[model samples]
Target: MRQYWINFKGNQEGPMSLEQLAQKGLDETAYVWHSGLADWVKITTVPELNDMLNNSAKAAQESPAELPEQEPEAVTEEVPELETEEVPELPQEEAIADEVPSLDNVIESPAPNYGGQQQYAMPVAPQQGPAPQEAPKCPPTNLVWSIIATVLCCSIPGIVGIVFAFLTKKYYREGNLEKAQRMSDYGAWSVIISIMLGIISMPLSCAMNIFKVAM
Candidate 1:
């Protein structure tokens, strides 16, 4: 009977007999055959066996020494060179050093205007502006709606809405318009749901009220 070393779900569990391994969902393809260890070695999940085989095959193909034969080296004979003519030399001038031009003497030409209009010299912009920046606009407050929602949220659903509304208010005060809007939406939806549930329960509550009235 064949022996196998099973590696399953990141755990190295067994060196069980092949029959035992098979009972645990092990198969010939699931594990690699290792002649040196005289056992089948499992690497990954059973379904990944084909991928492992392809990877192994690719690794074997990429190995260097398995390449084909080279062509024979060619022999070449050296040829002799012919003699060339000599060239004549020209005379060089002696250096006369003159005083360098002063910064004031150095003239700069005005930049040519590519456009038809005469180009006005551009003034450097100030690094800091004196203008006072306008403060960011505050989000619109729905105080009445907020109070109504908060009162309705006395129950579980209403409480959730009130929590969201509080969060929205806090974010709005902090100048986080986006987060405030999101929280407000949550509060609004929760308030609507809670109101709907309360309205639905009113009929049953009214029946109980009628029974008490009759008694």
Candidate 2:
């Protein structure tokens, strides 16, 4: 019923109802004039125009805007199934029962008689473990001679002779025949050396005793 005039694009558009002005997309900043207005004024200053603009803004906010439609997604391709393989069956075996012999099939051997003594097959003397390693055929340690030398001659070479004699016995026991023989020779030599030293020192010792007696 009430008519309003709008300054549309710096030109007087005019004489339209509030619905026409709202449809025209005018805002509060738009200049408008009407019969009761003194000169051109903003739409925000007029109660009727301002109220219409607010109501229109509220209605626009309440409604949703339309969106552009999207294209449908591409159809997926199906995968082909693989071929199945056939397995060969195994052959079955027939079960066999154990065969036992009767007493008629068995042959008995006659036992040997030894003057009625029930001889148990003398347990084959546990194969005598390689004949006890036959004590290595080595030379005798000259221990007695070494001891004799130690007691009757110079102590130094005599003691060495005794040591060699013991080493000969030790090497012989350890299965070292060559070392045992060598130590035996060493013992003999040491004994000989001791006897020779004792012989050489005897006259000197006697002469010294004689000299002391004379002095």
TM-score of each model, paired residue for residue:
0.30, 0.37
Q: Over the stretch 50-122, how does candidate 1's per-residue lDDT look in tens digits?
A: 3334334544567554322110110010011011101000000000012212211111222122221211211
Global Cα RMSD, each model: 31.0, 55.1
Worst 10 residues of 1 by lDDT: 87-96
Regions of candidate 1 where Cα sits further than 4 Å from its true position: 1-143, 149-154, 211-215
Per-model lDDT: 0.39, 0.53
Clashing pairs in 2: none
Candidate 1 Cα deviation (angstroms), residue 175? 3.5
Off by over 4 Å in 2: 1-136
Q: Give a tens-digit lDDT track for model 2, residues 1-215.
A: 44566664334465676657868987654656544322344456555555567666766666443211110110010011011111100000000011111111111222122221211221121111111112235576777877888899878888898899888877765545578899999988998899999999999999999999999
RMSD of 1: 31.0
Roughly what TM-score does model 2 have, to 2 decimal places? 0.37
TM-score of 1: 0.30
